[model samples]
Target: MRVTMIGTGYVGLVSGACFADFGHVVTCVDKDPSKIERLERGEIPIFEPGLDDLVAKNVKAGRLSFTLDGAEAIRDAEVVFIAVGTPTRRGDGHADLSYVYAAAEEIASLIDGFTVVVTKSTVPVGTGDEVEAIMRRVRPDGEFAVVSNPEFLREGAAIEDFKRPDRVVIGTEDPRARAVMGELYRPLSLSDFPVVYTARRTSELIKYAGNAFLAMKITFINEMADLCEKVGADVQQVAKGIGLDGRIGSKFLHAGPGYGGSCFPKDTIALVRTAQQYGAPVRLIETTVEVNDARKKVMAKRVEAVIGDLAGKTIGILGLTFKPNTDDMRDSPSLDIIPALQAMGAKVKAFDPEGMREAAHLFTDLELVDGPYEVAQGADALVLLTEWDQFRALDLAQIKNRMNQPVLIDLRNIYKPAEARAAGFLYSSIGRA
Candidate 1:
């Protein structure tokens, strides 16, 4: 299949590269000439685990290319994928679909023959209909089928997820579009990957509903961690016990600052807005969004509790990105926690293996350091926000000696409380006494 992927953000880039790896000729189109130039020069904008290698291999094999001209690629493509960002709107919390619609309009004018236009971006329900309407309005003579095919790729494990998705959801009633989509994913189909064909609206809702539920689970565990702390119980044990049950899986059960990333925060808020717009409000998800937002500041309070007076303290932070293996800082909990700490007059020195460059642009007052030990040097307390592998098994004694006060606050629960205590440090961890 000759595929043209528009808007080469995380979704577009990854999906395009993976499709190319599947032996499809893929051209990733972006409006930004600089981003397209970077891709053409063998530079990947975002950091994913195996994406650089995958893109390199595919480009070397002549199956993948990058372009700034969507018309050039769409004219020769069988499948045109709109993988643009559907960020939360400024005031309404609804998904900003302007980019998706813009891409649809451009594709409507550009596509030559019958094309299966798939919305691979996470969008609100009925967005496919709007996209189809936009295409028709722009070019009434256009022959294209708008299909909702939302992506489920995680940031860190996007390559693995794309190559071996648990299920592929294709939302379109057009038989031609279905056949084209099926052929596009035939490589995975041969491996028996489940491909669910559903109504367009249901497929769009599935993406939002799945993200909202995961966000709720994370918030639930975070609240449980708070309760466990008050009641002298361990949330980890609770999570383990309940996770063993087949009904409730263990994924996203870790108690941390909160859920913050490209998907959860925006998607959950968008879902709440979308549901309320139709008079079927999801109060549970609304509460989830509230709790998660408040949890970030609460985490700063946890650090404050350990440090006492924050005015003249120099706190060492171990990670800046939302999670390990990805440099995305869209709505990272650190964005909230670091700022809150600074507002209270605590100077922060942070280190993240991949996130420092982006974090530098976001933070102005903090000092970005080189290594974890360097960040810990002369700091009052060491706080672990993102559980990077480098921070997992650090020299505890060395860290304790380097810090001004021998304090360790493990928000990720990566260290044992007993071990930290044995290392002669006052330790604070989530949900464990």
Candidate 2:
């Protein structure tokens, strides 16, 4: 299938590259000249594992290409995939559909013949209807079918998720649109992944509901971790107990700082606002939103408490990203904690395997360290913020040697207290004695 992918962000780029890899001719269009130029030069703008090789290979094979010309991309394409970002709008907390809408109108203007316009961005329910309306308004003669096909790719493992999704949720009212989408995904269809066909609105809501539910699960575990701390119970064990039951599966149950990233924070708020707009509020989602917001600041306090006094304290932060394996620092917990620490007159030095360049702009004053030991060098205490894999096994003696005073606060519970205490360090971890 000849496919035109709009908005070459994480989703658009990966999806385009993957579709091209699957033998479809894909043209990824982005308004950002610099981004499109970078993609055209084989320089990937974002850091997704294994994407560079895949995209390069597809481009070499003449299947994948990048461009700033939206209309040109869609001119010859049978299917137009709108994988643009739907970031949360300011103040309103609603998804900012400006990009999605803009792409719709652009595609409408150039669309020729019958085209299956698919929404791969996570939009609020009924967005498909709005896109359809926009299409008709822009190009009165344009014949387009809007299909809701939300992506379920995690940042670190997007390609795999796209190739072997648990199931593909496809929402289209038209049989021709469904058949077109089916043909587009036929390569993955051979992989035995179930492709569920549902109504457009349901498909849109599914993405939000799914992300919000995962955020709730993480928030619930965070709350449980807090309670476990008070009651002298290990949250790891509590998570294990509930996770063992098949009904309550064991994912997103690992208690840590509040959920933050490109998706959960923005998507949950958008869902809450969407529900309110529809005259039916999701109370649990509302609470989840509030609790998670509170949780970020409380994490700052947790670090302060562990450090005893923020003033004049030099604290080493182990991780800066929202979570490890991806360099995305948007809505990261460290954004809340690091500044708070700095506000209290504490000197902060942080390190992340891949997030420093992205996170550096967020904290201009802080000293971005070269490594864990560099961040900890002569620092009063070290805080394990993101739980990167390398931080799992560290030389305790070396860490002790690097720190001024050996205090280790394991926020992600990556280390045991015994080894730290044995190595002459005061060790503290979340939801554990």
Candidate 3:
């Protein structure tokens, strides 16, 4: 199938590349000249594992291309995919659908024949209807089917998720649109992957409901971690015991600072606002949002308690990005933790394998260092904010030697308490005594 993918961000770029890899002719269109130029030169603008190789392989085979000329791409395309960002609107927490609607209007003017216009961006329910309405208003004679096909790609493991998705949800009753979608995802369809066909509204709600549940799960475990800390119990054992039940399989059960990323924070808020607007409020999700926002700030206090007086103290941080393997700093716990520590008079030095370049602009006064040891040097305590694999096997003795005082706060719970204590450090971890 010939596909035109609009908005070459994470979802658009990954999906376009993967579709191209599956033998479809794909043109990824972005309004940003620099982004399109970068993609054209084989330089990907984002950090996702295996994406560059996939894009390169598809481009070499003449299946994938990048361009700023969206009209040209849409004119020759059988399917147009809007994978633009639906970020939360300022003040209202509603999904800002201006980009998606604008893309639909522009696509309406350019599509030559019958085209399946798909929404691959995570959006509020009823967005497909609005897109369809906009297309009709812009081009009365145009024939197009608006289908909701929300993406479920994780940042670090997007390519793998795209290829081996748990299930593919295609929201469209239009037979032609369904057939086109089926053909587009035929590569995955050949496997055991299940493709669910539902009404457009249900499909859109599924994306938000799914993210809200996962966010709630993470918040539940985090709250359990707090209870475990007070009751002198281990949350890890509790998670393992509960996770053993087949009904509640262990996925996002790890107790950490909180859930923070592109999807969960924004999606949960958007869902809450959407549900309330429809006269059915989700109070649990509202609480989840509140708990998570407070959790990040409380994490800083945990660090403060571990490191006596923060006045004139230096603290070393191991990770910056919300999670490792991707350089996305949106809503990362470090964004909250670092500034809170600084406000308490502790100078901060941090190291992240990939997040520093982006983190630099967020914190100008922050001392971004060369490596872990450099961050450890002259620091009173070390905190593991994100669970990067490299930080898991660091030389403990070297960290102790470099630090002014040996205090280790493992927020991600990556280290054993015995091991850190034995290494001559005052060790503290989440939900473990």
Candidate 4:
């Protein structure tokens, strides 16, 4: 199948690249000229494991290419995928669908015929109808079917997840559109990945509900960690016990500062707003969002508790990205914690293997170091916000010696309290006594 993927953000780029790797001809379309130029030059804008290699190989094989002109990409494509961003709108918490709408309008003017236009971006319920309406309003003469096809790839493991997704959801009423989408993903049809065909609204809701549930799980564990600390229990042990049950999976059960990345924070908020507008309040999700937001600063305070206060302190942050193996800093917990630390007069130095360059733009005031030890050197306390592999098994004694005060706050609970105590450092962490 010849496919045109609109937008080149994380989901768009990954999905487009993986589709090409599936032996389909793919043309990635982006409005951003610079991003398209970078892709043309074989420069991947975002960092995802194995993405560069995948894009390069596919491009070299002539199965994949990129362009700034959306019309050109969509000209002869059998499937036109709208993978544009739906960021949280300012002050409303609803998904800002302007980009998606804009793409739809542009696609409206150039709808050839019998093309299956799939919404691969996470969108609000009824967005398929909106896209359909936009197409009709603009073109008023051509026939194109809009289908809902949301993405569910996590940042760090996007490549693996895309190649072997558990299921693929396609929401469309048109049998022709369904057949087209099915044929487009026919390569994955042999991979035994279930293709769920459902109503458009249900598919859209699935994306939001899935993200909300994951965000809630993370918040639940984080709150449990706090309770465990107060009640003289270990949250890790608690998580393990609960996670043993097949009903409650162990993934996302780790107690960290909070769930922050490109998806959860904004997605949860958008879901809450959607529920409110429709008069169905999701109280659990509401509290989860509130708790997660507070948890970030509380993490900084957790570090401050170990360091006595932030005033005149030099604190080293071990990781800046929300999670490992990606350079995305959107809605990262570090964005909140670092600023809170700086507010209290702490000099913050940070390091992330991939996120430093992106995070550097967000944090012009902080000193970004090249490595873990560099950030730790001469600091009063070292705070591990994102658990990068490099920070996991460092020489604890060497790190202890580098700090002005031998203190470490493991926000991700990467280190045991006993282990830190044995290393002769004052260590404090979430969910452990």
Q: Estimate each model's TM-score.
A: 0.99, 0.98, 0.99, 0.98
Q: What local lDDT does model 1 show for residue 317?
A: 93
Per-residue C-alpha lDDT of model 2 across residues 94-167, encoded as one tens digit per residue = 99999999888888989889999999999999999999999999888878899999999998999999998998
Which sections of candidate 2 miss by over 4 Å?
Answer: none
Clashing pairs in 1: none
User: RMSD of model 2, in Å?
Assistant: 1.0
Candidate 1: RMSD over Cα atoms? 0.8
Regarding lDDT, does 2 or 4 come out ahead? Answer: 2
lDDT (Cα, 0-100) at 222 in candidate 2? 90
lDDT of each: 0.92, 0.90, 0.94, 0.89
- In order of lDDT, best first, we have 3, 1, 2, 4
Residue range 247-276, candidate 4, lDDT tens digits: 998988999988888889888999999899
lDDT for each residue of candidate 1 in 1-433, tens digit (9 for 90 to 100): 8999998999999999999998999999988988988999899999999888999999999999998777789999999999988899998788999898888888999888898999999999999999999999988988899999989989899999999998999999999999998898899999999999999999999999999999999999999999999999999999999999999989999999998899999999999999999999999999999999998977889988887989999999999999999999989999999999999899999999999989989997999999999998999988999999999899988887788999999999999898889999999999986
Estimate candidate 3's alpha-carbon lDDT, on a 0 to 1 scale: 0.94
Q: What are the RMSD figures for all models against the true structure?
A: 0.8, 1.0, 0.7, 1.0
Which model is ahead, 1 or 4, in terms of TM-score?
1
Give me candidate 4's TM-score against the actual structure: 0.98
